[model samples]
Target chain A: MHLLPKKKKKPSREPYREISPGSKPVKWIYLSIMLWFMGRAIQAAARVDKTVKAEFDALPEGFAFSLGVFPDGPYMVLGKNIHGQVKSLGRRGQEQALDVRITIKNIEAAILLFTFQESTAISTSRDRLIVDGDLSQACAVIRILDIVEVYLLPKIIARLAVKRYPTWPMTQKMIGRIRIYFRAVLGY
Target chain B: MDTKEINIIQHRQPGIVESLPYNYEFYNPVKICSGKKAMAHIPFELAAINAVRPLVLASDSPIGRRAIKLLTNAFKESEMSFYVCDDVPDNADAETVRRLTTLYLEKNHDAIIVAGDGAAVDIAKVIRLMVAEKTDDLEQFEGEIKLSHAPAPLITLQTFDGSGLEASGWATVCNQTFFSAQLAPQICIIDPRMIIPMDIKTTWARAMVSLTQAVEVYMAADRNPVAINYASTAIQSIRKNLAPVFSNWVSNKKRLALINAYTAAACAFSNNQPGPGFLLGKAMAQMGNLNLGTAMGIILPYVMTQYMRKTNCDLADLLRPLSSDDDYAGTTSSLRGKKAIRCLYDLQWTWHQAGRRKIPLTLKDAAVGRYLFPDIIETALKNGLPVFDETDCETVLEHAWEAKPLNVTS
Candidate 1:
């Protein structure tokens, strides 16, 4: 009397694709999904850096960033010398630089490097890491590399020989450049 | 065809997610991602100069290999060193993909560029997902736009078009199972030269699918007006460009426009949420084991006519834009719908005039018969797609069986 009646039988789940005795469509599909996940993971691993994360977390209120980081060398980003000053603001803001300064330019450049660490553009090779893109995108990636080089790491014996940029602008300017570079790499 | 404004989030929700839908604010930075030979040549040299070593993932075929060679040669004189993974399998397993990622990391590649058709590009996308999300089995991420870590600079270049994977985050590895946005290739590179080399049958099939995609996006219950505008423009472009291809498949410019049309349609359809036409095609394709593109081809014209009959007023607004030859400034709903049907009919005629290149007029040509009708209906129902009922299914299929253009009362 205590034994419960047999539970109702469950309906079988239909296979998404019909699987024949030897059909491998399921296996193939699973394999495909797996490959997709792997590709994304690799891309993420290649971009994350300790300096880039720290720079992001340390942003001041109302301060934001964009950056594109490569797998190796000095992180770098982009900055334009308007008038004689380098501007930190990107496509959204309008605080255009009225006068140019080398220090400001380097700050802009450093910001670019930090931003790149969060970008989607970092890739790996057999013996070399490659960040692919046009001049503007490459500039953004370089800027992120610079941040990791000067701000995060104390001293560096090795460097990815990007464009030689002066480092004298404000720290915010550097962070701004990296933020833009991140946007470029992430294709935001 | 009788459309009540649909909420796209609700349609694909039960199968995909729990939170109904997250607010999806979508924007296309550039309407199209155009890649010149110069661009292909530049990324590596620039990357190398900065010592950024990105992963280069290409289809394991001669054409893809040539693309890789083109870049290496261009960058060789500029002192850039690139490592190419043209060795990825056509049907790469999960283990193989993980190995590729590990190799990429060990070798210090910066990012990835996937070059080829749907399979090859999808493979590269999957590889990116694995590295970003830390997963080997991709099924766990199905039906969600789930992404944790950021992907590398991933660009997909189409070697052949019409798969619709270029614009949509979802990729169909096979019939029923799919991979979601986690595998969305960040950037897409479209080059006309890539499509020109494909066989005629494949081109026609892909174009037919593109047409179906545009119509579905336009008619989706969740039809975003913006997506609709894009869809309409895309349809017009495709109808105009594809008409001449049956006769002359060698026109690169026209081919470019047609490919562009496909991209536009794909972007519009997926972003807006797929409608009845796409659902119907998917169901039939999975059940009958037919080519999805060809199935769409056979059914699309019929669906358009029926949709016009059901939602005559909305149909009119849509057709008004296509009637470039008519005084469409203030046409009535009936008139606009008729004009649109007439325009579609004209496209069919053009295809006939070109070479009678069209989807088969009857199921007999598709190698199935009236006997298969019940199976089609059953499969559609089982898939849980939103349809009025069996009668609605029969009505549309009958129209497809007849393959006659609607008599537009213009």
Candidate 2:
């Protein structure tokens, strides 16, 4: 009687698969463009922006950080303070014990900030940025970014990007813009 | 820029101004039982939540012992059954949580009763989480992992009034913080008699923590109308009862007011995350081994000053509750905010004098040197307040280090 009733075989659990095959390539293309622009922005700031240099110099020696999107990040910038240079470590930055790490919530949020649709404060207040490590250091980094924005973006766009824009002499502004563009294009 | 343009710009900025069109969500499901003998309602509260057998947790401290005696005496005359575990140590870690969870499951307890201060409450929450999740590994639930099922019904009876864990959804198990709406106590009982043995210094510090929370709720960027109303009431209650409670002139009325303030502040704080002041104070406390309440009291004004600078929100509204009617009425709208800030500075000075300098007014006074500033900032950043950077932390800490009255004037 016991041998007459045999248990039915259970179905094996299936691994999760993406339902939409078309979305993968679109996401990669979007990420690539975002990373390219981010690299260009960092290069321009490091080369010509005095404020960025000063901020990096003020940081403790051997301080490093990563700025990226979460989960599927290209990790836009992995920078370290090397004699105040703020040089990029490229993809290798993730392995370091970074002093600060600022992760945007998603690709959409990143695009909004990078494209000047939303300001840093707006994005932060909206709870889009997830910051890790030293808060004070992160603040210093933000200030430096604001300064760089003034140089890279036009006055109208810069006004939208920052809370309060510092007044710079016309000659200094013109010189800073020219140098930023030249270095950004030539990769100096 | 013209005055009009400047005003426009200020209004448009997101965190700087409390602008409309902001999105936020808030939910709190705590039933509070208060009064002279609120602990008497425990049996009824337990029954409401359908909990027959509750595993009671109490610390070994005098207050904790007293709480257990009171609770046991009350339960002896009732039909409900409770098992008391009075050996809960201070700063209970993961191992303690596991042992307690095992005990709960083995005993077949249907509810958890945390009958002491913040630490006991925190331990019970974690134990409940472990039991509900049916796992000893608490790490899986850290940092905002939503629980699929409701936690075992928790009834918290406060022995003292400092920690806002009574109504908060967040709990720090070991060094890692965990959050779940279900973790908030199903019923919280606050009675003044429970805190009678606690010293004046501790009472004052705890009250100050509540005051700081209420103030931060009002100043927070994500604040809603519901939270603001609760915060305003909390501020008023704290202003009325703080000094009286500290002086040991134990009026049940004043004590009750203070308890209500703590509850209101907890409700508001539960709706929002801790602000810069809470984060900085927590960090400083951890680094210096100082009481969180004391650290918060010292750091409150400085953090408020930073918030005022960022938001440019009118602080005059605070004066009505914090100061006299004359002070609120006589002062012009423009000067009222400054007056309110000045009043907070004066309050700190007054408390410092009343305590006969027993309370350290400055970080330097507390023997916390500048060397720990970097560590403190890092701790604060990790805790919360992502909007603040290292520069803001430095500025706030440097100002707090000196512990001078806030420079209300520009």
Candidate 3:
């Protein structure tokens, strides 16, 4: 009698499961902070650095572009205003028009670029980034990104991030890095 | 073996392989990278084609996501930042295809990397077709396969679940059939990490489809030795691997072997016209809304028997790949074809039992009645199977429905 089959238990059914879009919140916040500083730094660097000033002079007046992740962005829009200065517009709203847009595909790819894990040249070549705008203007924006990356990161890391590291005098490199960091923090 | 007798034609430039009538016209241009760390070699393949930007399309299932993670890890040490759209719909809605097209064009994606099987692979092939050929409307080319030039570089990363034709020159996009040798994948990467462990039903369908392809190539009307070599190897590999996998004694190596067989079978079947068993399987799958592999598996034995009755070629050769050394030798020459058919039926019986009768062994078992049989014939006619006709399709389907072998002797 004890060896007889026991009553069958009902199998608990699992609720419906779906794939959620994998997003990294910490990285998003990190990229946002970095872009904010980088924006101010570029605006400041354009005024102080002679090389950046020359690149801006070559650009057509009112040339604007935003570099950020697609769908959701923590971007810094840089443009040549009528006053003949580079202003880092922190996170351009949809209402603001742009002439060029450089988009990184995802947060993971963005982290790779921001963390100096992959160089800008490598990212573009590997198709991790997309440029939607005038080709020549986009190229100029990329050049600006390379110059700014060199200023933000250390020599060893900066060398890896840029295609061809510039041969600058020690004083110029040190002085430029200091001035950019100073202006970026001072809200110049 | 004379030089004058064999004029070997080589493609002067990459991406074009020419097949000639004279001698052994053997051609499979797909550069396959298999075994361990095969996924790591994808970057090198991309470099060879001068494609820096690749848009990855993958299924959104858990297994598909896992495959993406593996692919992502493989590109870890490299500087490549390939874009991925992992949310591809399973049924391949037109909107998803159009949206991906916009993304591909906007981003200037140079090549395509398709991860996962079925709809994801189909969309990747169709996307490449539309972009490369500049075809705005795919509906115009329905029913007939068309291509003037090879599409952009496509690399398919698939699991064990597939029609086994994902890497072939065939695509079933939005229920429309398209075929061109140029549509085949340029780089077919088979990594063990991509293998997903599935139930008996899924395995049965996939293995059955692989078997049909190899069998048709091995027993084609116009025999080509090179193609037969490919089919023979696949059959033997399937025989060695399928049992261990199906009996719940699964391993990574066995899974890789089955995938290898699928690729090998595709190489052989791509060049030849699909056989009665292959064509009938396609038709039956459509008619009954059945898994392509399941439908093929159900019709294989009966179709094999009927194919023997008509071809009257020595069916004894099939036994060699399907059976072991001692058992094949024990079976006498006269009874070899009969023994081979028995072996196929035995395999089917085993599948039916293992599936707890969930795997159908006959058309009736699959809930497909004779009322739908005419639809299969029309589909076969649409495919224009060379050695098949309406009557032949009906005869195979009739026996396949009853779970009985054709009793006619040549």
Over B317-353, each residue of candidate 2 has an lDDT whose tens digit, in order, gives: 6776678767776777688777777788888777777
- Per-residue accuracy of model 3 over A68-126 as CA lDDT, tens digit each: 86545767788889988998765963446888888775566778889988888888876
Clashing pairs in 3: none
How do all models score by TM-score?
A: 0.59, 0.63, 0.63
Better of 1 and 3 by lDDT: 3
Candidate 2: list runs displaced more than 4 Å: A1-188, B1-24, B324-326, B405-410
Question: Model 1: what TM-score?
Answer: 0.59
The residue-by-residue lDDT of candidate 1 on B326-380, one tens digit each, is 5454555346656666666666556645645444544456765666667888777
Candidate 1 overall Cα lDDT vs. reference? Answer: 0.51
* RMSD of every prediction: 18.6, 24.8, 13.7
> TM-score of chain B only, all predictions?
0.80, 0.89, 0.88
Model 3 segments more than 4 A misplaced: A1-188, B1-24, B143-146, B247-249, B325-335, B353-357, B408-410
Two-chain complex of model 3, DockQ on C-alpha atoms against the true structure: 0.02
lDDT of 2 at B408: 49
Maximum-TM-score candidate: 3
lDDT score for residue A92 of model 2: 40
